[model samples]
Target: MADEGRRDRCLAAHEAPPVPPEGPVTTRLPRRSFARSATEVAPELLGHILARRLPDGVVLRARIVETEAYDQNDPASHAYRGRTPRVRVMFGPPGHLYVYFTYGMHHCMNVVTGPVGTASAVLLRAAQPLEGMERMSIRRRTDRVRDLCRGPARLAQAFDVDRSLDGADLVRGSEIWIERGPGASAASIRRGPRVGIRVGTDLPWRFWIDGPWVSVSRPAAVLSPR
Candidate 1:
């Protein structure tokens, strides 16, 4: 069919480019980085690179711009009521993905933090696409690069993340991982309350780098450099 042919061509055009012969020269973050509370890891994740590798050898890399922290003590956290089947990964070891479906149509991803048996995670809210723009555009259904991974759901979709990747280990996985990149300066980080949560509305656990790639536009308090 002509329509099918057009669709195939469109997809081919968006296919990721071949990887360099030498392979990706990036340093993966150590698991110890996530062996703390979510609030500690969330702001520090800003500016780090989150990379996803496709089966066909294409790698998509993005710089984290915004994140939200959640822990067992937080009323808005999934672990607040104690561990359940759906949130078991949050109580597992650190440096694992905690992908969850939300709103019946979208998938959001989080990085597990804290010691084993403790529930803590950082929600990756937004990122700036640094590579595989064409592939991400196809997945996100938008040609505008700025809109590709502007929110948690959009970020997951752009990276082809889903429930299947819920327990994937980021520190050791070949498919998806976080790499060390330039960190956001303390003075450049902003803190604010987590979004779209009915409870724990007053705790300023959300953090973001001052950048156009940030998902939300609300003003936040600036942190003084240490």
Candidate 2:
């Protein structure tokens, strides 16, 4: 795809504003109204690129890895628990932000996956470490390629994504955006259960490029359920 080369080659190869010396005014579509819907959001994100601006001012990018769909009917989702200040954004339109704090102090990000009111979203489980490799190494404090951006929480930190990015838009924003990345050869695309959710694990919602070191975990090729 048009973005794969941009990502695979170099972060600067893509035409995005460099992080300003004093931080430019954040301008873009307000992703405050998009609801989270997993079913619709997962498959749609397959070829999209997920990018974040790092601390050093370089943009760190990754291709979407495994994703899980969450919706109202999906008992495992947080929305089903009802609206609170934290999830209020999930109740907004179809292009809003849904940010939350979990695992003690780490922050994780999710794209409101489906249309408004659907409350479905795709959980960005893992990403193939792309641009900003050195900076990523610094933030993650590791030189091991597989350890960086291998999990939802780690990727968020590596990309410098936090509550600050909540409600940021992807269609036209510098903070986070997806570009068309490499096509997983039909045979290379692997699918399975979404990670870490005891309830949703039964559903075949996870997806990843077979054997790409960037997959958050080295899950064996799953042909069917566990």
lDDT of 1 by residue, 1-226 (tens): 1255644542453343423222453478889999998989999999899999875768899999999999999999999999899999999999999988888899999999999999999999999999999999998889999899999999999998877677877876666789898988898899988898999999999999877788888869996664
TM-score of each: 0.88, 0.74
lDDT of 1 at 54: 70
Using lDDT as the measure, which candidate wins? 1
Which portions of model 1 show Cα errors greater than 4 Å?
1-26
Go through the candidates in order and give each one's C-alpha lDDT. Answer: 0.86, 0.62
Give the least accurate 10-residue stretch of model 1, judged by summed lDDT: 13-22
Q: What lDDT does candidate 2 reach at residue 26?
A: 37
For model 2, where is the 10-residue window of minimal lDDT? 20-29
